[model samples]
Target: MIQNIVLGQIKRDPRSVAMANAYGTIADGYFAVGYNPAMLAYQQDKPFMLQLFGIDMGIGGNFISLQNLNSLSGDTIYAAGENPKNPHDDSKDRLFRQFDDAGGLAFRQDFHLPMPIINYSSGNMAFTSNLVWMSNLVFPIGILELLFYGNGRRPNMDMTFNVEVFGVNELGFTFAVPYDRFALGATVKYLQGLFYFGVDPDSSRANLVTSDYHLYGSGKYLFRFG
Candidate 1:
């Protein structure tokens, strides 16, 4: 439904909107994978590179990248804007907490999901983030369930439980090259994220001090390619 609504808006001017969306898709590095996964396939003999970028749109954007760290490792660090709350308070602990908390996991209490794997490969895996359980399954099937409708707490769990993520979570491969432009190489890609913080608790759109208190999610999806 969200995609349908978004697509509908773009359909009004498919040409320009499509191009804009295409540019963004490319900017995200998906084009690199689509254009030539082969080029990214080679790694062992390429010079490692690190890229750092930033942006300012009344707010701000900052990012860093490490490419081809040896034959099997890489990393990236990124942060867009300083949270309005306690923006000037540069304490190490809060910064560290913000860096690790992600995927809204820090907003609510008493949320749990058994990380179950549904698919696996040397460099890729697919998993279910959500699950459904009924009390009858654990209790009784024939008991006179008088207290049936709304008899128990309907807990609202994290989105990961209901949302399905089919992604290239990890990728790696080896390629053969010749002398000069020929060599052998390999690569590895890994993915992880955490998001916290609830939606704006009140009309106050930005995080601030003394007015209210809330948790926010901070997460980044790192990409690695040689």
Candidate 2:
């Protein structure tokens, strides 16, 4: 579904995810040139960096990230997406904002866990893997409530739609070799499983109709770099 596409985009892209510090993995930066940790160690000359983030639609602003980078064996490193929310704003109702029949919005004031990615070298060969997670899901209560009450207040029509399951997770792997003054690599991605969802159409709840989500695919390519 398109919802999945949007979710995947926000997850894979640094510009969109806010807390994503790793480059190359997205489009820019060199970290993504290969999936191997050994390749990253090559660039350890750069000191660790931390990013402070915040977001708010209009009234108030909320902080969301505290990340750090350091060196490790084979040039592998890890980053945690964590921060704390104030004492006041701590409820699901307050954690998220509902825009009409749209989905719920939550401010990930604190990251669930540290997203880890690693790269390593063995002789002329290198390898890398990325395991990251973020929360951008907006679950609208209005939609779920409608599932129970046919017409919570106004009801006249109904709607329903369905599509095939394509994938649930995205996995990327890279294989590379070191050459004179440079490293080269190629990646293969495997998108496994599929999930589908559709809502019924109803005029009163046109906002909660099946035609709401914007669907797209979650696929990418990997290339070599030094």
Candidate 3:
């Protein structure tokens, strides 16, 4: 079976969209609670700033060219699915040629809640508390090839699907301190997995909850002597 999908542009607020440039707060205003915590100390005396209900969604992939698929006419290579069991000829070759790339499809969306919950700043230290809902989906060609016999390696043309949907609810705290031309930042997060649905070729899974709870943290030091 061959599948063709076309993705669309996502819409998000400025704050959420700016998260992509979270490299090190090189742009205007101090952003990115984790990436550049130290920059928080350099901000104006706002004492508190809130981020409410911002969302981010991104799609990137070029597995197959839609133009190529649409250009074909009746009885073309992508016309219909045929039984590979009775095939031993050039028709098999045509099936492989239909898909342009068959690489993979990736999608992710982050929902920032209306909880600055702790967007407070004091002296040279900044603290932030927030929650984010994240989800990701990826369908790789290699795995699809296994399930669909797209590579024709499976003995039988039997088709199976591997659908995995992952979701995470994360609560995080960020702290930052700046000194002269040096800056330091740290972030701690508590993660709760919402769902995990997929077929594990190596193991077995009946439900979609992989991890109940998890903890993650990171620290960064920036020596900006310039």
The number of the candidate with the highest TM-score is 3
lDDT of 3 at 206: 21
> Quick one: ranking by TM-score, best first?
3, 2, 1
List the candidate 1 regions with Cα displacement exceeding 4 Å.
Answer: 1-48, 54-182, 193-226
- lDDT (tens digit, per residue) of candidate 2 on 1-226: 1122222222223353464434333332223333232353343433332212222111111222232112222432111222143433323232223222233222321121112433332333333332322223333344434443434332322222211112234454444555678766565555543343323222113223322344222222232121
| Root-mean-square deviation per candidate | 22.0, 18.0, 15.1
Q: What is the lDDT of candidate 3?
A: 0.42
Candidate that would win on lDDT:
3
- TM-score of each model, in listed order: 0.16, 0.28, 0.48
Ranked by lDDT, top first: 3, 2, 1
lDDT by residue (1-226, candidate 3, tens digit) is 1010221111233654457543455422224454455666676674555443344443333333466455543532321345454443444344444331432444444454434435444444444433444444444333444443443353222122234445555555555677878877665656666665555534421211112253222322222111
lDDT of 1 by residue, 69-97 (tens): 23224522222333355455444334333
